[model samples]
Target: MHKPQGYPDVSAYLIVPDAAAVLDFCAAAFNADRLRVIARDGGGILHAECRIGDSVVMMGEMPDGPDAHLHLYLADAEAAFDRAVAAGAEIVQPMQSQDDGDLRGGVRDTSGTTWWIARQEEA
Candidate 1:
């Protein structure tokens, strides 16, 4: 009906070269749960959704796509960053405390999407 449960009003939609790999990376890197995958008749994923934290990220397969940059706030940003690297994501920035009261880092997944992970200090 009106937006799915546990999904934010504004969600990020990503189109990548390999939707399946991105889905798997999201699961491993962010502990996201794969929710749905609608496949094309010929082949490849036409659409997919994953629940990362309280947000639902929609994705589809598009070769050499326009890359996306997503920022995520997590309880343990370091662990998530480690998991992302272990899952084949290239580290673009190291985790470090920021003046804005957040520990942040970044990584680029194989699908060309860059993820900025942070653990925000409680105000």
Candidate 2:
């Protein structure tokens, strides 16, 4: 089957309580770009798409419970970790340089989604 234009082979669909806030946080913390957003008449988001680097993440407000966590990759793990913290995310793990040569860390967003941010260390 042919894939849609501008979409990756795999993408994450997130259902959170507050789609708008999550979108904003992604933009501020990860430099994500808002691709599209559909809002409900009742003042909540129905669906939205955001681009972080070349990957796109689809998100919407959940009708009931919380959403699942996600893992993200950044060129600079430390900077992304700090930006996420400043944007109201709490640190789940401090940045560490792994033996495999990856810098990684974890943070939980305001809506309770955990993100594992990492990058391959330079040679």
Candidate 3:
């Protein structure tokens, strides 16, 4: 199957209770760029997409959307974690260097998604 240009081989799809909150949190926390939004007729979002680095994150608003967890690798995990905290995310795990050669941390956003942010610390 042919994928969209610049899209990763695997993408994360989020089912959120509030698409706007998800988009805002992703923007503030992960530095994700909003790509698309299909607004639902009454008031909420039907579908949306955003880009974080090379990955495309798709989402839809539903009353009973399931929660999600994501492990995202970034060039600067520290800054991302700080932004996430500033954006009202609850700290799930503190940032630290792991024995597996990575600096990692975790946070839970307003959308109920736990993001595991990490960076390579060694080769």
In TM-score terms, which candidate is top?
1
What tens digits encode model 1's per-residue C-alpha lDDT throughout 1-123? 696667789879999999999999999999999998999899999999999998999998889789799999999999999999999999999998889999999999999999999998778
Writing each residue's lDDT as its tens digit, candidate 3 over 1-123 gives 597777788888989888899899989988899998999998899999999998899999877878799999999899999999999999999999899898999999887889999999977
Which residue runs of candidate 2 sit more than 4 Å off their true CA positions?
Answer: 1-4
Q: Write the candidate numbers in order of decreasing lDDT.
A: 1, 3, 2
Each candidate: what lDDT?
0.93, 0.87, 0.91
Residues 1-123 of candidate 2 have per-residue lDDT tens digits of: 487688898889998888888899999899999988999888989999899999998988875646577877787778989999999999988899879778888898887778889999889
Please list all clashing residue pairs in model 1, or write none if there are none.
Answer: none
TM-score on alpha carbons, each prediction: 0.93, 0.88, 0.91
Misplaced by over 4 Å in model 1 are none
* Decoy 1 TM-score against native: 0.93
Q: Give lDDT for model 2.
A: 0.87
